[model samples]
Target: MLAAAALAIAGVAYSSWIFDFIVPTGQDRFRSFLSELEADDVPWHQVYSYGDIVAGVAAVGASLLLFGVRPAGRGATTAVVALGVFGTATVADALAPMGTVPIVHAATSAIAVFSLFVTMGAATWSAFREDNWPIMRTLGATTFALVAIATGWMLGSDRLQGDYLLGLAQRIQVGAMSVWLLVFSVGTWSSTRHARRPKRVPRRR
Candidate 1:
C-alpha cells in the first residue's frame, strides 16, 4: 500500500514537471489564445485551465494512495470518481487542437467539478474512522477536497485568466500535495507491518 502511494506521488510529480516545463513551452497556439484574451481585457481562463490539469492529476494520485492505505469502500469510490474526471479532462485536451468551443470546454470542465465531489466524499468517509493517526488522515483528506473544490470552481466558472504565475502556483500545489500522499502511504504500510509481527512468549521454570 505504502509503495503504491509512493509511486502515485512520484507519478504526480513527474506529470507536474511535464506540464510546467514541456506543455507550456511548445504551446504556441494556446499561448496565443491567452494573449488574445488578455488583449481583450478578459479574465485569464488559461491559468485556471492549467491549474485544473495539475489539480486533477494530483487528486487521482492521492486517491490511489488513500485507496491502498485505507481500502475502505468509500476510498474505492473516490478513486473511480477521480479517474473519471482525469479521463474526461484528457479527452477534452486532446480534442482542443481540433477546436475550442463551449461543448469541448464543458466536457473537460465537468472533470474538475466531479473531482471535488470525489475528494469530499472520500475525505468525509475517512474521517469517520478511529485510527492511530486519524487527525492526519482527516487533514490530508480535507486539504485534497478543498483544493479540488477550488480548482473545480475555477474551471467551471471560467475564472482562470491564463496567468502564467497562477498556473505555476497551481502546479506546485498539486505536486506538493501528491508528495504528502506518498509519505503518508509509506508510513501507513510500515506501521501496519510493524503491528502484525508475532509476539515472543516467555518460558516458565
Candidate 2:
C-alpha cells in the first residue's frame, strides 16, 4: 500500500507546475502544448521526455498494486485496467514525440487522454457501487465531473480556436485528472488498510 501511494505521488509530481519550472524560454504554458517542451530543439528536451516516462511507469505500477487490492467488483476492476491503458499509452506518447513522429504521437496522445478519462469515470462509478469511504467516493464523483467538463472544453477549444486556447484547455483537463489521481491514491490506501484489518467479534457476556 505504501508502495502504491508512493507511485501515485510520483505520478502526480508530473503536474503542470513542475513542467512550468522546467519549461524553456519562449514556451508559454498557456499557448503551447506540453509536448512542445519535448521537441528536439528545446533545451533539455530529455528532461521532459524522462518526466513522462517516469510518470507513466508510476501510473502503471500504482494501477497494478491497486488491481491486486481493489474492492471486489467489476467496476473497480475496469477502473484499474483503464488506468493501466492510460499509463501504457502515455509511455508510447513519450517514445513517439510529436517532433519526431507526429502521427504516432497524436494517436498515442489520444489514447492516453481517452483512457485517463475512462479511469476517472470508472472510478467514480465503482466508488458509488461499493459504497465505501464516503469522502473518497464524493471526491471521485466530483473530480470525474470536473475532468469530463475540462475534456469537453479542451476538445471544443481545439476545434474552434485552432490552438489559440488548446494549451490552456489541455492544462485544465490534466489538472482535473491529477486531482482524481490523488483521490484515487487515498482511496487505494484506505482500501488496502480496510482489507488488512482484523474482523470484529462480539465479546461473550
Candidate 3:
C-alpha cells in the first residue's frame, strides 16, 4: 500500500506539472487557450482530445495498480473512479462543444472536481486505517481531509481565486498536505521494516 501510494502521488505530481507539454501544443498554448476560452473561440474537440489522451494514460497506470495488483484496494478504487470521471468528462466535452453545449461542459467540470476530492479522501482514509502506523498516519489523514474539504469549498464558492491571500493559503494548505503524505509514506516503510524483523529471544536468567 505504501509503495502504491508513493507511486500514485509521484505520478500525479509529475503529470500535473507536465500536462501542458504532454498535450499537443505550440508556443504560448497556455495563454492562447485561456484567451480563446475568454473570447469564446476555443475548440472543444481539440481541448477534449488532448485532455483525454493524457488522462487515459494515467488511468491505465492507476487501473493496473488498483485492480490488477490489489495491494491498495480502496486507494486504487478512488483513483479508478477519478480516472473514469475524467474520461467521461473528456468524451462529453469533445462531443459537445462548449459553445453548443455549455451546460455539458459545466456539469463535467463539476463532476471532475468532486471526483478529485473523493480520490484524495480515499487515499487519506487508507493511510489512516493501516494499523501498523497510527499517529502520523492518522494525523496526516485528518489534516488532509480537513484541508481538502476547506479548500474545495472555497474553490467551489469561487472566493479563493477572487482573493489573492485566500488563493495563496489554499496552495499552502495543499502543499502541506502533500508533504504530510510523503512523511506518512516514510513512516509506513519504517513500520514495515520493523514488522519484518525477527523476534529477539529471551535471555536466560
lDDT of 3 at 22: 64
Over 1-205, each residue of candidate 3 has an lDDT whose tens digit, in order, gives 5443543453344233223346533425322322123123433334434443454344444445444544345564664466456545544544554566778766865564466456556555555663434434567566666667656654554543443344344444434544543554454456557667999999999
Q: Model 1: which ten-residue window has the lowest total lDDT?
A: 31-40
lDDT of 2 by residue, 8-52 (tens): 664575563455665554677776788887888887777778877
Say which candidate scores most in lDDT: 2
Q: What is the C-alpha lDDT of each candidate?
A: 0.46, 0.76, 0.48
Error of 3 at 110 (Å): 1.5
By descending lDDT, how would the candidates be arranged?
Answer: 2, 3, 1
Off by over 4 Å in 3: 1-53, 72-83, 86-97, 131-205
**CA lDDT, candidate 3, residue 48:** 36
Give the number of the best model, judged by TM-score.
Answer: 2
Worst ten in a row by lDDT for model 2: 16-25
RMSD to truth, every model: 7.9, 2.2, 7.1
Residue 39 CA displacement from its true place in model 1, Å: 21
Model 1: colliding residue pairs:
43-161, 44-160, 44-161, 44-162, 45-160, 45-161, 47-162
Score every model by TM-score: 0.46, 0.89, 0.48
